[model samples]
Target: MSATAAISVRGLEKSYKGSRQARSPVLKGVDFEVARGSIFALLGSNGAGKTTAVRILSTLLKPDAGTALVEGASVVEEAQRVREAISLTGQFAAVDEILTGRENLVLVAKLRHLPSPGDIADGLLERFDLVEAGGRKVATYSGGMRRRLDIAMSLIGSPSVIFLDEPTTGLDPEARLEVWKVVKELTEQGTTVLLTTQYLEEAEQLADRIAILHGGTIIANGTLAELKALLPPAKVEYVEKQPSLEEIFLSLTGSTKQGDHS
Candidate 1:
C-alpha cells in the first residue's frame, strides 16, 4: 500500500459464481492508483468491470484475490475505515422521489449522526445550486437537479474519496455538462474522485489522469498528453488524413472496431 495515494490497487482479481456454480471472471490482476484531489478515470465499455472495481474500492464488495487501499487504509483489512472515508454514487440518481430535496439531504445527515443536520442540508443545497428547488419534492425536479442532489448527499460526511460509477449515464447533453461542472468543482475543493465511464469525452474532459480498462485490466495508463503520444504523427499526403474522435478513442482503448478505415 502506498501512503500518499488516495486509492491504490495491485494484482486484483475477482470471479462470480453464476448459474449452478458456473464461474465468470471479471477482473484479472487489475492495478491502478489515484492521486489525492485528482480526477482519475477508469475508461471502459460496458461489462469491462468498471463498476466491479469501484465496488471493491468502496468496500461494498470483496476481492477474491489481490489488495486494494483507499485513503491509505486497506479496503479488505480496514473495511470500516474505508467505508467511512468514501462515498459512492451509482449509475442512477439515488434520491428519494417522495421526499423534498432538502429532506433527502437532512435525512442523510441525520443518518450519519452529524450535529445540526438542518444547517448541513441548507449549506449543501446552496453549494449545489439547489436552494431554489430545496423545498420541492425530488420527483418534480429535472434530471440534472436530481443528479445534483444525489451528489450533494454524498458530500454529507465529507469523505476523502468519491466513487462515481458512470455518473452521467442517462443524462441529456445539458445535464451531462452540469454534472461535469460539479465533478470539476469537487476536485477543486480537494475531494479525490474515481470516475468510471464508457463515454470517451467524459474522461477526456474531466480526468487529470486516464486509465484505459480493457478486459478487466488496464491496457493504458497516463496523463492525457502521455496517452495521446502513443500514436504516431499524423500522415501528410496529397490531402492529410485526419482521424475522427471515435477513431482515436477506439484506438487508445485497444479496441479492434474501426469500420472501413479507407
Candidate 2:
C-alpha cells in the first residue's frame, strides 16, 4: 500500500457458492488504489460488482481472495479497524424513520461514541441545512430532507473515509445538486470518499478519478478527461426552447426522472 493511498486493493476476488459447477466470480483479480483525501468514483451497470467491492472495503463483506487495505490497515486482518475508520451511505436513506432529524444524528453520534454527541448533532444539522426540519420526524420529511438527514447521520462519527453508494438515486434534480454540494464539502474538508454511481454525469462532475467496472473487472480507470479522451469526443446537440423535449415527453407520457438537470 502506498503511504498516500487511503485504500489499496490487489488481486481482489470474490465469488458466491451454490449448487454444482461453482466458482463464479463477482470480482476478478481487481486492483486499484485510492489516494488520501480524494473523491474516487466507481462506475458500473447493475450487478457489475461495484457494490460488492464497496462492501469488502467497508468491512461488511470479505473478499474470497487478494488483499485490501484501508488507511494502510489490512481489511481482512484489521476488519474492525477499517470499519472504525470508514462510513457507508447506501442506495437508500439510512436515517431512522421514527426518530426526528436531530435525534437520528445524535443516535449515530452516540453509536460512534463521539465525545460530544449533542454538539456534533447540532453542527451537522446546521451544516446540512436541516435545522429547520430538525424537530420533524424522518418519516414525515420530504425525500430530499430525509436524504440530507441520512448523509448528516453518516458524518456524525467523523470517519476519515466515506462510501456513498448512489446517494442521489431517488432525488430530484434540485435535491441531487444539494447532495453534490454536501459531497463537495466533505472533500474540501480533506475527507476521502469512495462513491459508486451508475450516473456518468455524477462521475464527471465530482470524481477526481474514476474506475469503470464491466463484467466484474476494471475495464477502464482514469480521470474524467482521461476517460473521455479514450473515446471520441461526443457531439452535443443544443436546442433552444422554452420546454425541452425530455420535459415534453415526461409531461406527455408521465415518466419519472432522476438526477440534476444542469
Q: Count the backbone clashes (under 3 Å) in each candidate.
A: 0, 0
TM-score of each: 0.93, 0.86
- In angstroms, give how far residue 61 of model 1 lies from its true place: 1.1
lDDT of 2 by residue, 1-262 (tens): 6888999999999998758868778999888899988999987766778889999999889899999999888888998898889889998998788989888888878877778888998898899998888988888998778878888888776789999998999788888988888898899999999999877678777889988776677867787666656544455579422433223223332336532321
Model 1 C-alpha lDDT per residue in residues 1-262, reported as the tens digit of each score: 6678899999999989999899889999998999999999998877888889999998889999999989888999999999999999999999999999999999999999999999999999999999999999999999989999999999999998999999998899999999999999999999999999888788889999999877778888988777776777668988866554345668866577632210
* Candidate 1 vs. true structure, TM-score: 0.93
Model 1 spans > 4 angstroms off: 236-245, 252-262
| Number of clashes found in candidate 1 | 0
The global C-alpha lDDT for each of the candidates, from Candidate 1 onward, is 0.89, 0.82
Name the TM-score of candidate 2: 0.86
Candidate 2: list runs displaced more than 4 Å. 19-21, 233-262
Root-mean-square deviation of each candidate, in angstroms? 3.3, 6.6
